[model samples]
Target: MSSAKLSRRRVVGAGLGALSSAVAGVSAGCTARSGPPRRLLLATGPEGGPYNAFGAALARAVAASGSRLRIVPVSTAASVDNLRELDAGAVDLALAMADVAEDAALGREPFTRRAAATALARVYVNYTHLLVPADGPVRSLRDLAGRPVAAGAAGSGVQVVAGRVLREAGLGEGPSPARERQLGLAESARALREGAVDALFWSGGVPTPALSTLSREVPLRFLPLDGYVGPLRERYGPVYTAVTLPSGAYGLAEPVGTLGVANYLLARGEVPEAAARELLTVVFDRWSDLLREVTAGARLEPRFAISTGRVPLHPGAVAYYRSVYG
Candidate 1:
């Protein structure tokens, strides 16, 4: 095997071993149940984003795999909204950003109390996009002050990070604050094109379809956000990391540095162990299909999937990881 594969194997083995201790004495309940395939509701993002595409693909893949779980993807505002829905028993599964998930798990702002959610996997990294018109006067993060900007839909993870970024750049406080507009990807793109918003914030996999389409229609410039990663980590822990949007994406002339946040596949803690294991089995088996829909280059590796930070793993997920490592 290649050195990389060997190293990955070592990491997975060690990580699983460490995680096994946490799940010890934890009951996974019955592994056998008899009935028609159970239908599950999965909360995803807006229509044109990566979360929506990936959720739809995952649901189709689960059906095609002949699993006993029937996943039904539901479109939502994404992240915070998804977690809130899951908490309310409105959804069986949800896709959420690590930062927002951490907030929900810890009972932070936007969440009045701790949430009962656990992770199945760290699905992928969301690259933050601060898009401005090529001919627009906004040259940097500082330039966005006192300007109209689409900061993402109200209940979305994009909004969570956008607010932080804007504040870190000293735009959302005191006088001369940037005018914040709450809009989803499609609406934000249209607003930007119409000169209604000076810039827009989006957090998703590379070459997000709507943004890619918008780029073809208008010359675009992406502002670099690497400078804020350090401060974000300092204030909010290590959930934020520096990432780069490659040059070829959205017709960029060069690579742009940006913030990266992990996206997690979350489940309510009450989900049956058998159902969770079966869901993950199909997901890992058909992960390539999900990637084809979500992004150009992303992996569903077990080692990376198990690193969900403060959000505990679902017992079913822990069982699945143990089985894989063993």
Candidate 2:
């Protein structure tokens, strides 16, 4: 309760202490003194996705800590949408792809304006999945140029990453234009099965439930992305990593070299450092529990978590890390 941000929304979860709060002006901005934050909203990805699952589990862990702070997990389009939520003051914290945060901070293409956000910490690396049917003609990302492809839901981090990968692959303005469909994770899988899309791009943790289910129902294969990693990293900063998607993931037979992007936890830059610190404390303390429930959280290492690229780390997050690591 010592470091919880208060908002008008429903509580995200209870904090460690059963403290209460009294904000001088919640709508204008919270100025609470000596009480648990009434509520907090955490912006996460779509339902049934890794982001949402992990967010829900995090809410549960915070509530179980007995802090009396109520944290509500919000499911959205993910990344870009989460940043928007934070900008609109609809959420207290959010999970975002580092590249998206970098773009948002810079007010680059896609984002019309700069957002008042800063990195709480780096979290995980989402492996980019360029999947096609095992028996289909779309053997690689280049092969799907003329075909209908579900790049990702409109404005989602998935689509953003996909667009970058396509550009780096020299398919940005190729002759055979890809009919990119705006589809969510589940919808993309169903559309692929229904012959609506020849290939689909996804950016998430390994063993994403929807992909696993899609693999079981249909013979699907992921195109290797390692070839573009070097170029992507060179162009898009160090956020892009060349990593091999382990074999047996989503039932693949052997490892496939692919590009991975770092994911981040962010909060409004206006949020008090102490509140940010509390959020970090809860996360670090209960991180193991989150990992046990969803291995996607296993990447929440202190060292990597602090590697927030272009997005500067929050002061509170900095303090928390020093207290623990030092």
Candidate 3:
């Protein structure tokens, strides 16, 4: 911590006392061992994605906070790939799904190596949206029992959550015999428009750019998944929560209630404490302005961001949480 600047005390004894105090104060101000400013890499997702916008906002906020930290926006898939970047030292910070972060940190599923990363905080929930044709009858997960569904690409977090949701609804293990297609978000949107697929699963923030762009031309229907909330919460630990996407978020008819998982900010265990403190401070202090930059990032709050599941919080983040919120 930097020492507070002190004014010279009243000189009662001799002129020597006042001179000594002034010299000491000046020396303290000049020689205080402040840590060097750092440049950090912030790994987000593809262009027009929530992570991309949020990352840019964070960068601006940090710069405005008088912190000598730079947030370099790196494009990533934000699933297992983000964890790999942190492990390989290609990036210092990343926006990652809580469940995926947990698995990688614990060396569970996709992550063969237990990632040396820690959570900064949970930012917001990524609600799963099952988008279908507006005129279709697929109002719920069960309605797609035999229809063509485009699950997201393999190795993506969207696919992981979609698979889990399907399993919880007793539709996994290929039991439903539905026509399933594996494709990316863009491909799925095209497939849905072409009638090649009846439904598509997209797990992202409300008003996702891709979904919004699709809504501009196609009449998209958001399928609700409330029935699986209880079962999903019970099975997936506390990561799954009931969330609602407001009406008109994507020019929809009404709000869509569904289950979702929180997204978290993560960093390698070796990030400097001072750097973390300043970075988090920037995020919280300039939150409102940052939200203006990334419309969806308005959900970021210091109180809500700290909601980590089982993953351990980084020591630096812990200090910030204590100093400001304890």
Error at 63, model 1, angstroms: 0.8
Give lDDT per model, in order.
Answer: 0.85, 0.76, 0.72
User: After best superposition, candidate 1 residue 243: deviation in angstroms?
Assistant: 0.6
Candidate 2, residues 224-276, lDDT tens digits: the string is 99988888777778888888878888888899999888888898877777777
Model 3 per-residue lDDT tens digits across residues 174-270 = 6664566777788888898888998999888767777788888888888888777888677667778888888879997789888787888898888
lDDT, model 2: 0.76
State residue 251's C-alpha deviation in candidate 3, in Å: 3.1
**For residue 87, what is the lDDT in candidate 3?**
72
User: Per TM-score, what order, best first?
Assistant: 1, 2, 3
- Which candidate wins on TM-score? 1
What TM-score does each of the candidates earn? 0.89, 0.87, 0.81
